[model samples]
Target: MLIRSIRLAGFRNYTEAEIHPSDGVTVFTGNNAQGKTNILEAVYLCCTGRSHRTTHDKELIKNDHDFARVTVEADRADGMHDVEILLSRISRRRIKVAGNTVSKSGEMLGHITGVLFSPEDLRMVKDGPAERRRFVDMELSQLRPAYYYALQRYNRALKQRGALLRELINAPAASDTLDMWDAELAQSGQAIMTMRRDFIAKLSEQAGKTHEFVANGAEKMEVEYVPSVRAEESGEELRTRLEKELHRARQTDIRRQITSVGPHRDDVKILLNGLDARSFGSQGQVRTCALSMKLSELEIMKKESGEAPVLMLDDVMSELDPGRRRLLIRMLSGVQTLVTCTDIEDLAGADAGKIIRVHQATLQEA
Candidate 1:
């Protein structure tokens, strides 16, 4: 899938902007604070129905403006699709695909898959588990709608269970109330865990292979799924094990006033030669591994959807070495990629003819 064009009104720093993006290597070049990243963020929002930078929808609107609008034209397997998003101050945001309002956000996944790489992503390896979990969750949500539904259900159940736990803590006599919530939580949590395990397994296989190539065959990397509950089985047997573990942790959970074991506490562990990469790997190693994982995710999405996702590189080429940058460009040969940089000179040896310069959110054809 690729974005053909985009129109923005009252968004961030852009008042009224209409951009026709090229499918092959459209470059956004501008100095800092010139709305270079904002354009890419608009495209990212169109793909996921959420912003990569902030959670507040109102912040996306320009100051003193009550609403913001984004219209995206993308080419998918079905045909060219027009996605429209309306952000208002007092009402919930609106999303429409080809003039049809999308009541449920889950229905929007997989239509237009996107991969965003930024300087913030390089810290995903050293950051908290939430960051890594987000990495896995974001891709899985786009690849599998079932996983997205499960995640929504799991999050709701967790909140309800936590509330019950708090209630039980206030009145220990209501201990019986926790049983029902526990059962519900276990059912959904177990399903999420099973799906996550399967997902990480596939992801690790592809990421490891890619990492080896990116490392110049000098380093071997392994991705492992670290679940909070340990069991040596699969399928129903695994579910049974999880149930029993949850039951066993009941007392400890009550003492702590929090649910302690589930996918919420799980992690994706990166290992290089049997050592934890998150703690011991060099900064370069960590960044390379993250990049490898993202590229592998793109390949997986293509295999599942039969179309390459629109690739967005937001000032990330500046962070990579010349060899790695070349490798990334070569890998995206068949896909449409939009890259953001401070200057076209940064692309130095790469194809300069395709560069689209940006000056204060306006594109200048090369």
Candidate 2:
């Protein structure tokens, strides 16, 4: 995958800007808050239907502007593609792919797949299970649209179930209505868990290999999918297990007023040398594990999609040690990568195809 150019208007600090990126590596350098990361954020928004930084769409619109627009032109293994996102306060955001407006957000999933690593991603190992779960969900959504729709269904059912549980807290007679939502959760959640199981199996293998490469074979990294409920049987069997578990935990869920057991409560376990990375690994180890997972994500996207996904690194070099930085650079050959950093010297000697200096929201070639 290659992103040829990105066009922006009223997005963040950019009033109007167009940038042409080379196929190899493009570097955007600037001081703090010069909109270096915002450029990458625009590209990420085109790749996925959401922002990496904020959840609110209105925040993406520049002050004094009612809308923010970002358009991306890329060349993938299949064909050339164009993705455009229009964020508006007047109505819901709109997406267009290849000049055709996409009705559902999931329809734009594979048009231009990308993998991004920012400083905040370091929390994947140090933070709670939500981080790891998000990692799985984002990657899978890009690779499989069916998985995305399944996730949507599962979340909807989960929301309804939670509301019902809350109402049951006030009146217990409605407990009879809970079985319908339980079945919905079981069916959709089973699909999600099965796919997650297979995807993590691949991720674990790739991450283990990458961790060994980065650690020089001195440490072993292990990644496992830890679903809230164990599933090791036919599809019907798994769904049945989920329904039974939800029903069995109904009293507990009513007391807490939340859906307590399912894929929504699942996690990815990261281990180093047979010890939990979140609890036992050093700070350096935690960062290394995160890096390994990201690299693995890039590789998996390439293999699964039949094209190398565009890689975005947002000021991550400063956080990595020199050796890890070198490893990352060595792995960028033949892959389209966009990197942002405060100083260009930190990434010295890497063959950057285009170097742009971002100062005062104005981009100038270095």
Candidate 3:
């Protein structure tokens, strides 16, 4: 997939702007807070129907603006396509693909796939498990719409189960009502766990090879999915395990007013040379692990979709040392990449593609 252009209206600091990017490597250079990241954010929103930075749509719209509009034009293996997102302050956001309005936002999942890396991603190793889980979720959602559906259902059931648990605390007589939610949660949770296990397994295999190359075979990376329940089982067996676990944790759930055993509490463990990357790996090791995982994502998406996904690097060059930066650039050789940075000189060998200057919310081809 290649993003040919992106048009923004009333998004962040941009009043109105259109950017044409190169198919190989497009660099956006500007100072801090000059709306460089905003461009990448718009592209991400158009692709995923959500922003990585904020969950609230109101935050994306400009001050005093009623809505924020972002339109992206891209070329995929099939053909060219257009994706548009309109975020309104008073109502829900609207999404359209190829000139047709989509009622369900999930329908837009794989229309324009992309993998984004930002400075914050450098801390993913040391960050909480939620960060790692999000990395998996975003990648899977783009590759498989079925996974997205199961995830949504699982979350809804999880929420209802938690609410039932809290209610049971106040009225023990309502305990019977928990059975319905438990069964629903178990079924959906099983599907989610199954997919997560497969995804993590594939990711680990690819990341190991990438990390070896990135780290010059000095460090080996490993990834594993740690489910809250039934770590070794799946399908009906996993569902049965989840049902039993939910029953076992019912009392604790009621007392704690939370669902205790499910995929929500799951984690992905990253290991570097037999050491926990999160707890023992050095800063350089963590960043390299993160990079390897991201590069692995690109390969996974290509395998699943039969084409590479667009790559977005949001001011990530400044966070990496010279050696790592060179490795990352080498990985972007054939993939279409959109990068944001403060200075072009900071990026070695970045002059091969188009250079667009972003200043005062405006873009000019350099």
Worst 10-residue stretch by lDDT in candidate 2?
Answer: 231-240
* Cα lDDT computed for each candidate against the true fold: 0.80, 0.89, 0.87
Give a tens-digit lDDT track for model 2, residues 167-254: 9888999866798999999999899999999999999999999999876676999899999999666388899999999999999999
* Cα error of candidate 3 at position 227, Å: 1.0
What TM-score does prediction 2 earn?
0.97
Residues 1-366, model 3: lDDT tens digits:
888889999999999999888888999998889898999999988777779899989999999799889999988888998999988999988999998899887898887888888877866789898988888888888888888888898898888887777777778888777888889888988888898999999999999999988887888899988888866878899999998999999888889999888988999999998788999988878878888898899999888888888899887788778877887788888899999989787788665489988889988888
Where in model 2 is the C-alpha error above 4 Å?
none
TM-score of each candidate structure, all chains considered together:
0.94, 0.97, 0.97
Q: How much lDDT does candidate 3 score?
A: 0.87
Return the TM-score for candidate 3, rounded to 2 decimals: 0.97
Task: Rank candidates, lDDT, best first.
Answer: 2, 3, 1
What TM value does model 1 have? 0.94
lDDT (10s digit) by residue, model 1, range 1-366? 878788999999888888776777788887888888888889888877778898999999988789999988888879988878899998999988888999988877776678888777766677877888888888888888887887888788778878877776667787566666666666777777777788788878888888877777768887888888873455677767766777788778877978898778888887887788889989888888888878888888888789999888888778778887777777777778888898666676666326666777666776
- Compute the lDDT for candidate 2: 0.89
Q: Kindly indicate the candidate among 1 and 2 with the higher lDDT.
A: 2
